[model samples]
Target: MTYTIRQAVAADLPLLADIERAAGALFADANIGEVDVDDVAELRLIESVARAGGVFVAVKDDAPVGFILAAPLDIHIHIYELSVHPAHGRQGLGRRLVDAVCDDASARGFKAVTLSTFRDVPWNAPFYASCGFRILDPAEWTPAFYLAHYHEADMGLPLERRCFMRKELK
Candidate 1:
């Protein structure tokens, strides 16, 4: 199916939260404890990120089916969240969203794109690795990376099972 990728507007913000919830549900079957109960990005946060030109939606039939939220952190753009409704999964929407952020960051002269994800989840760190991201060792953590990990830990995520990854943009 055809899909359009574009920066999100205010009207698209609420749908992004819904998409996040739906996409996150898949984790229920992954043997990861309670990930499905994790909170999604709130509309306010999504809106704030969008205002920064860091929210992008994948649209089909004029409605958002997936989205990626990002923000400037240090010299890189950090992907705060990425979600695609399961009905549209395994069709490259996630990669498209990642590419959208990477391309925009490249054009704007950002050095890289960064994110934190579950280290052992097949669709988490491994998928990002396939997208050219490398798992960043703690020694490589920037201030922004440290801050990201702090927030993730505060959210009750298992730090030992989590890792930060980065994809440098040319």
Candidate 2:
């Protein structure tokens, strides 16, 4: 199926919220625990990206099926969020979204792109690793990165750690 990816507009907020909720629900069902979904601060962060970053949504027949959000982080790019509706899973939408973000980062001359994901969850860290991200040591991470992007949701599993991952844009 053909899908279009384009910059999201302000009018897309409600649909984007729905996508967030759906994606959160998927995580919960997978035993990832509840994300701090009602946090207004987090919502505002996403809003900021929607307003400024390379915020792109995947649409099928003009309805949003997924979205990828990225923003500048010093000399690097940080992928704040990327989600595809459960209905569209295994259809390559997620990969396309990440590719779009990476393409933008490279075009903008960013040296690297970074993200964090659950260490043990099959759908979380491993998925990113398959796409060429490697685990980063916390001690080597910058204070600003730890402050801006790290969250408890990245560590929902008791025995599982949250790991930072980075990919060089070269």
Model 2 residue pairs with clashes: none
Q: TM-score of model 1 relative to the true fold?
A: 0.95
Model 1, residue pairs in steric clash: none
- Error of model 1, residue 129, in angstroms: 0.7
State the weakest 10-residue window (summed lDDT) of model 1.
Answer: 32-41
Best by lDDT: 1
Runs in model 1 with CA error above 4 Å?
36-38
Task: Give each model's whole-structure lDDT.
Answer: 0.88, 0.75
TM-score top scorer: 1
Residue-level lDDT tens digits of model 2 in 53-130: 668888898889899888877667888788788787788888788888888888888988888677887877898888
